[model samples]
Each structure stands twice: as structure tokens, then as C-alpha cells.
Target: MNGFTRTVMRTVLQAIPTILGIIVISFLLLYLMPGDAVDAIAGMSGSASQETMDALRDTYGLNDSFIVQFFRYLGGVLTLNFGTSISYSAPVLDVIMERLPSTMILMLTAFVIALTVGIMVGWAMAVFAGKWPDRLLTSTSLLLYSAPNFWVGLMIIVIFSARLQWFPSGGAETIGAALTGWGWFLDRLKHLVLPSCALAAFFVAIYARLTRAAMLEVLRQDYIRTAAAKGLHPMLIQFRHGLRNALIPVTTVAGMHLGNMLGGAVVVETVFNWPGIGRLTMSAIAARDTQVLLGILLLTSVVVIIVNVIIDWLTTLLDPRIRS
Candidate 1:
């Protein structure tokens, strides 16, 4: 089979066990909770008779035994029915879908910024090898990686947003606002600036260090020395041979970080008040919105599984040895 087909088949095989495991875990935890969905809903509503609550439970099939509820949840999931949110009074899938686009946009932009800048800075450090630039870059990366994300976010807010008045302090956009042409685009970008920086800074640091190390190691290889001795231009040697080999390690790190960036955007999202899944999930948990919580958990697990599969495919492309 071709590479694409082989990859899809392999991912499907791997996904079976992962999906089952997620289902089992989600089912067991939610099932073991003290109250049924009806109880949660009634508690929010202030008061309801026992008969009314029991009837509601029966309507939602919460009256079923633990094993029966598990089967029902599994069956619903198979049909792509994530069920209604007890708190939101809306379908769990709808709520998630509504917030997904914003989260993806924020994460995609952050990832792009992190990867591009990190690689470029890292490449320069590698080229310089033992020079001041290398040491400076390494030190800067270590500092950023070790710094607390919330603190960095607060600093950015204070200096840039509050003091300088250069950017929005919080929220995706002003309430009841319409964007006209490029003005809207620019406004949205203004909102993204702080949060994206807060999210990408730490990742950029690690990426630069990793890329520098990988590139330096590749530079020391015999083939690299042979390329240099052949009188090939320095740029050609670095770009064609050294960079490609260095990228094998970068790709692995990038793939791992990509999945993390998607799920780990919570801090940035919360700080900036962006209307994304992270904020939504956090609120759900605090409010005891079990359906929303469950939906978010399942969605995160699925993304992780898909990312791992994609990383496996990328590994083959980066280092053809994986093809064997």
C-alpha cells in the first residue's frame, strides 16, 4: 500500500484501543459521581419535588443501572450524540463546536509564530556555534521556559495594555461591535497579540534550544564535514544537509508541542478572556456542568490521539528510517 493508505490504516488500528480506553474512563468516572443529571439540573433550579426529579431522571434514562448507563452512553457516542448539557440546556456537541473555531485560530497563530521564529533564532545560534549569540539565545530560552506563564501574562497586560495603551487588556472584542474591512481584522489581531505572546513565548524558548542542539549535533556528523570539504557553499551545506537533519528532532518536538499548545491554551485564553474551549471547559468544571466537562474531556482525548497519529506519519517523512 501507498504511504497515505498505510498511515491511515495504522492510525485506525491504534485509535481503536485509544477510543475504547477513553470511553471506559469517561464512563466510569461520570457514572461514579454522586448525583444523576436530573439532580444536578434540579439543584440549579432551586427546588423540584422528588416525583418531578425522578420523572426527569427516568426521561433521561438516568434511572438505568450503572452498566446500562454505560452501554447507553457508548451507544450515543457511536451515533455522534454527545447528549445535552445539564447546565447550558443545549447539546454538548453544539456548545463545543461553537467555541472550537476561536480556540483553533488562537492556537494556530501561536504555533506558527512559535515555530517560525524559534527555528530561525535557533538556526542562527547553531551557525554561530560557540559565539555569544548561541549563549544569549540559550540563556534567553531557559529564562522564558522557567518563567511562570500567568506572571508573564500579567506583566504584558500591565506594560503594554494598561500603561502604554497599545493593546486590549482582555476579551475577544467589544460587545455589540461590527468590524469594517481591515479595521475589524486589525482589531481582532490586537486582541490576539498579548495572549498569543503569552502562549508562544515559552514554546519558542524550548524550540530554539532543541533546534540549536540538534543542528550542532548534525553539523558534527561525518557527512556534514564531507559536504563542507567538497567546497559546497556554506549556505548550501547548512540548508540542504544540516538543516534537514536538524529538523528531524525539531519535527518531533514540534509535534509534541503542537498537541500541548492546543490543550494548554487555557491559561492564555482565561487571562485574555478569549471565547475559546479552554475558558468554556474551565467554567463548566467550576459550575459542575458535567455534560460540558465530559464533552471537553472526550474532545481533548480525540485530538491527542489524532496528533499522535499525525506525528507518526511526520516521523516517516522526516527520517525515512521510520518507513521500515
Candidate 2:
């Protein structure tokens, strides 16, 4: 097989141990927590009899020894069976699947917005280095980077939703809108705008700063000087050579941010009341739904590992030096 193929295979193989470690650690930690699924359910019932609680513990195998329970869980995970949610009375995977699409839409939209805006702004800063434009961009990015996402979200909601009434304050759609076609599309987009902006705000700042730094570093390289001396058009040199090289670091950060967002924009999702995995995860934690919580953690770990692998592959593709 080719070197790249081998590299990819090796990376995938390496990730198995990491995944197993996550499972073991998360299982043990959760297992050692104060209460089990039975307590959570019995608490909700308010007056559940000891016999009822005992039956539940026995039925769900919560009464098993810790090692037996963990191994049983590990075996289920190996077969793609994430078990059932104690609170939801549904398979963990099924519950996650139902909410996954909304989260994906929000995260992908935010990622595109952050990447595009950050790159453009950062490139502008590089082009106007040491000038008023650069100073302004730098200051703005720092301010944004320092601000909390939830606060930004609330501020936007106040101005746009509460004051101007331009968009809904929260939710993925209108409660009972029967619209279709472009109308439905527009409605969804409107609902998405606020949350997307809030979620992307901090990431946009991070990308902008990283890209600007990368670009500045790249611009000082010997090859950049050679390209400039060769009489290539300045714009072409910047875009074709400088920007492409600068993107190496930017791409890595972008992949990490994408993975983080995929794991769920918990704060932003909670603030917006969006019915996504993040919100679901919060509910699971509050209810102590062990199966759902474990399922989310496993899914998140897998997503992060996959994203990192993709970033590594892309980096090698972008800079052949990495292949060696």
C-alpha cells in the first residue's frame, strides 16, 4: 500500500486504544458517582417503594459487580449497542440520532461562517499590516475573543429579538408554522442566525488571530521574498503562495474547533433552547441518565478522534514535509 494509506491505517489503529481508555475512565468515574440510574428514577417518582427500586436495580443489572457491569457495557459498545436511556425509555443511539441533525445544522453553519469571516478578516489584517486597518482588526478580534459566548448570545438576542424583533430569541423553528418551500427555508434560517452568530463569535476571533499570525509568519519566509522578487503579481503571490502555506495551522485549529462544536455547543445550545444533542446531554446529566450520558461521551470522543485524523491527513496533503 501507499505511504498515505499506511499512515491512515496506522492512525486509525492507534485511536482504538484511546477510545478504549475513554470508555474505561468514563465508565469507572460514572460508576463511582454517588447514585445509579435507579436512584434517579426513584427520585422522580417521589415515593417509589423499596421493592420497586430494588426491582429496577435488578432488572437493569445495576446490582451487578462493577467489573461485570463495565465489561458488559464495553461489550455492548463494541457491537454498537449503547444500551437504553433510563429517563427517556428509548435506545441511547435512537435518542441521539433524533437530535443529531439539529446540532449538525447549527454547528456546520457556524463553522462556515467563522472560517470564511475569520480568513477574510485575517487576510485583510495581514495585507494591511502595521496600518490602522490591522490595528482595528486586531483590537476587535481580541475583544471578541475575550467575551463569553453566552453573554454575546444574550446581547444579540436582546438587540435583535427583544428590541428590534428581527429574529426569534430561541428555538430551531416557529412553533406551528405550516409553511413550506422557500418560506420554510427562510424561517429556519432566521431562527438559526442568532445562535449561529453567538456560537461562531469566539471561534471567529480565534481563527482570525491564528490566521493573521500564520500569514505574518509565512510572509516573512524566504520563498515569499523570492516570489515577490520574481515579479509575480502581489495579489497572486499572497493568495496562491502565502495564503496556502498559512492555512496549514489554520486548518488544524479549524478541525479542532469543528470537533469541539460537534461534541456540542452546550452553553449556546442551552441559551438558544435549541433541541440538539447539547441540550439533550444537559438533560441527561440533570436526570442522571447513565446510558445516555455514556453514549454522548462515546460519540463525542469518536467524533473528535475522526476529526483529528482528517486534519492530519489534510495537513500531510497540504505540506508533503509531514509525510516524511
Candidate 3:
């Protein structure tokens, strides 16, 4: 097989173990969590009879053996049929899909901003190694990295939203806002700014420090000296040679962060009251909506696996040493 094909095959093979592990682990954990759907709904609904609870249990297939119920859930997922949410009385997939777009937009925006700003800042710090710029970048990155995300989020809310009244305090858009044209697009962006900044703050710090450290290490190598001796334009030499080598580690960090961005959307989304998957998941959990929780967990596991596979492939491409 060719390089690309081999890499694809390897990724697929690796995914099998990951998928099976997640299925088994998630099933066991869910089963172990106290209270079945009937008990949960009964407690919440109140004044429920034993017969009604029994009927509800049968309807959810919770009456089946643990192993049987697990396989049934797994089968439904594989068939793209996640059954229905006990709490919402809607198809599980429908509930998840309804809130997916908002999360995806937030994560993608944060990832792009974090990477672009991070790499540039890191490169600048490396260029001015051991100087005032390097020290400043290092100190700032450490401080930001140590700061709490919720705290940062609230500060953004207080400063930008409350004090200046420059941005919306919460929600994806104004309650009755219409999604028609450029006006809606601009408004949506305006709402996205605070949450995106809160999410990207720590990431920017982490990536900047990581990239700077990697670049510093690469710059000490013989090839960097050789490139300098060749009299290549300083900009070209640093970008083409220094940055390329430095990217191997930075790429790994960025890719992992991308996967985390999807999961971590909950914090930013909740704080901003954005209608994203994280908020959806939180509601499902609060309502004891098993189907929605299971579906979301499975989907998130698959995404994280895909991200790692992509990272591995990129590693081989970036560093020929890993290709064979």
C-alpha cells in the first residue's frame, strides 16, 4: 500500500480498539450510576404508581438484563437509531443535532484564533530569545495559563459586556433575532467574541509557550546554523526551517486542544448561555436523559479518536523520520 493508504488503514485499525473500549466502559459506567429511568422520572414527576413505573421501565427496555440492554443500546447507535430521550420525549439524535451547530462554530472559531495568534507570538518570542520580548511573553503566558477559565469568562462578561456594554452578555444571538443576511452574521460574530476570547485565552498561552520552547530547541541544532551560514534571508530561514521543525510539537498540542475544544464547549457555552452541544448535554444529564447522554458521549469519543488519528498522520508528514 502507498503511504496515505497505509496510514488510513492504521488509523482505522486503531479506531476499532478505541471504539470497543469506549462502548464497554461507557456502558458499565452508565449502568452503575444510581437510579434507572423509571425511578428518576417517578421522583421528578411525583405521585407515580408502581404500575406506571413498571410500564415505563419496560418501555425503555430497562427490564432487560444488563448485557442485553447494553448490546441493544450499542446496536441502536450503530444503526443510527439512538431511540428517544426519556426526558424530552424526542428522538435522541434529534436533540443532539439541534444543538450541534452552535458548539461546532464556537470550537472552530476558537481553534483558528488560538493557533494563528499563538504561533505568531511564539515565533516572536523565539526571535527575541532571552530579551525583554521573550521574558514578557513567557511571563504573560504563564499567568494566563494559571488563570481559571470561568474566572476569565466572568471577567470578560464584567468588563466587555457589563461595563462597556460593547457586547451581548449571553446567548448565541438576540432572542428574536432573524438569521437573514449580513446584519445577522455581524450580530452573531459580536455575540461570539466574548466566549471565544474566554476559551482561547488559556490555549493561546499554552501554545505560545510550547511553540517558543520547541523553536528554541530547534534553533540550537546544527542545521539552523548551516541555514544561517547559507545567507538565506533571515525571515525565510526562520519561517521555512525553524518554524517547520518547531511545528511538530505545536501541531500535536493544537490537535489535542482541538479535540478538547469540542468537549470544553460546555463551560463557555453555559457561561454565555449559547445553544451548543455542551448546553444540550448538560440539560440531558440534569433531566437524566440517558439516550441523549449516551449518544453525545459516543459521538464525542469518535471525534476525539478521529483527531488523534489525524494528528498521527500529520506527524509522519511533518517529520520524515516517522514516515517509515
Model 3 root-mean-square deviation: 1.9
**What is the lDDT for 269 in model 2?**
93
Q: What would the TM-score be for candidate 2 when compared with the true structure? A: 0.94
The candidate scoring highest on lDDT is 2
Candidate 1 Cα errors over 4 Å, as ranges: 33-63, 321-324
Cα deviation in Å at residue 227, candidate 3?
1.7
Total clashes, candidate 1?
0
- Note the Cα lDDT for every prediction shown: 0.83, 0.88, 0.85
Residue 49 lDDT (model 3): 98
Give the range of the ten consecutive residues with the poorest summed lDDT in model 2.
Answer: 255-264
The weakest ten consecutive residues by lDDT in model 3 span 255-264
lDDT of 3 by residue, 259-303 (tens): 667766888888889898889888877776777888888877777
Model 2 C-alpha lDDT per residue in residues 112-212, reported as the tens digit of each score: 88989999999999999999999999999998898988899999999999999999999998988888999999999999999999999888888898889
Best by TM-score: 2
Per-model TM values vs. the true structure = 0.89, 0.94, 0.93
Q: List the residue pairs that clash in candidate 1.
A: none
